[model samples]
Target: MLDLRDVTLVGESIGGVLALTVASALPDRVKAVVASNPYDYDRRYADGVRRGNVFANIAIGSYAIPIFGAINAALENRLFLGWVLRGGFYDKRNLPRDLLAEFDRVGRRRGFRYVERKTFAGWRSWNKARALYKNVKAPVTFVYGDHDWSKPA
Candidate 1:
């Protein structure tokens, strides 16, 4: 077990949901939380598909499938990953090429594709994490990017 305490948890996207969940579970250890674009709402994935561009719609929708989804995720290239990442930024320039390249490289690691697919498949369960918010005694702050595609303005 981690002998950590008085932690300030910060996370983005699905990670944001995780931070909130952890804070709720360990209110004593977690002193504060910053959740950005938390994936806690119902139909979060469907809404993203509906609002996303053609490329995003295709890429995200395919992840919902079975065998084909795994194949698609496994075959994801740098360009496709760049497109998805840039879509999250209001100013595309904010995502430097080096960071994008690093993200792509990490994504290509063995087992990463399988985990990505599993995370996408588990969205429904993660959405229920919102219920844990009421239990969080720590101060919580939420951040939303101007171009956060997951949320409607």
Candidate 2:
């Protein structure tokens, strides 16, 4: 077995889900946990939206369309990417140049787009794992931003 020490787990977004799973399964190995914007798969509001909304259905279903890749590529173009990134922030006017540059840099990395798409698709399948959250024994901290759109859901 590998020797591990001082294991403080930190994760953001879906990675938080994975960190929670690990902490739950190996509580003794984890010293502490910090998760940012972690998703709650069992949220009633999200379930209701998925079941009741046509737009949500369309957005999810569009992944299967043949032209989806092309559309994604077009949207990720420089001009549109700025718009997309700005829309994600509550205060778009003051976004740091370095952050946008970092986003652009990361977006251009090979296979990043494919992995991002797959990660989102996998998010829908995480409901079954929600039960595991209750089993985590480590001290956990969750952080969220007030302006995040996901906060209301």
Candidate 3:
């Protein structure tokens, strides 16, 4: 376990939602939050992808399926991952090769794919986590890239 105290939490994408959730739960320990491209605004999992690409929206929906989802996850190679991730950046150059490599490495881990599939399958529950945002007493700074899937509203 980590011995955390008076901390500032920073996260991107779904991780941003996680940071806010934790800060709300441990209000005294968390001092501030930096959330970039948080997934909170989307009412449905597919809605987030719809803002970016139609094909990606369909693919994201398919991730909730059992057998087909496993097949899709298994078929995700570095090129495919790069293609999907590059869309999130306003300037593709911002996504360095090393960062993409690191993401690829992490995605290939044993249970990582399973976790991603499960997360997509239970996206409604995760989306509901936005309700916890009001409970977060810590000051939050939201960051958004020009081409981020989440719109600044």
Which candidate ranks first by TM-score, i.e. highest?
1
Two-way lDDT contest, 1 vs 3, winner: 1
Clashing pairs in 1: none
Best by lDDT: 1
- How would you encode candidate 2's per-residue C-alpha lDDT over 39-133 as one tens digit per residue? 65524323322332354434434543557843654356555456555554668676687878887888788887666556555655556566887
Candidate 1 residue lDDT tens string, 62-141 = 87788888788888888988787666666877889999889898998889987877777787887688888999999999
- What 10-residue stretch in candidate 2 is worst by lDDT? 44-53
Indicate the worst ten consecutive residues by lDDT in candidate 3: 45-54
- Model 3 lDDT per residue over 89-149, tens place: 6776788899899999999999998888776666676678888899999999999777566
What C-alpha root-mean-square deviation, in Å, does candidate 1 show against the real structure? 2.1
Error of 3 at 114 (Å): 0.3
- Best-to-worst order by TM-score is 1, 3, 2
Given candidate 3, what's the lDDT at residue 10?
Answer: 96
Q: How far is candidate 3 from the true structure (C-alpha RMSD, Å)?
A: 2.4
Per-prediction backbone clash count: 0, 0, 0
Model 3: residue 148 alpha-carbon error in angstroms: 2.2
Query: Residue 17 error for model 2, in Å?
Result: 1.7
Tell how far residue 87 is off in model 1, in angstroms: 2.5
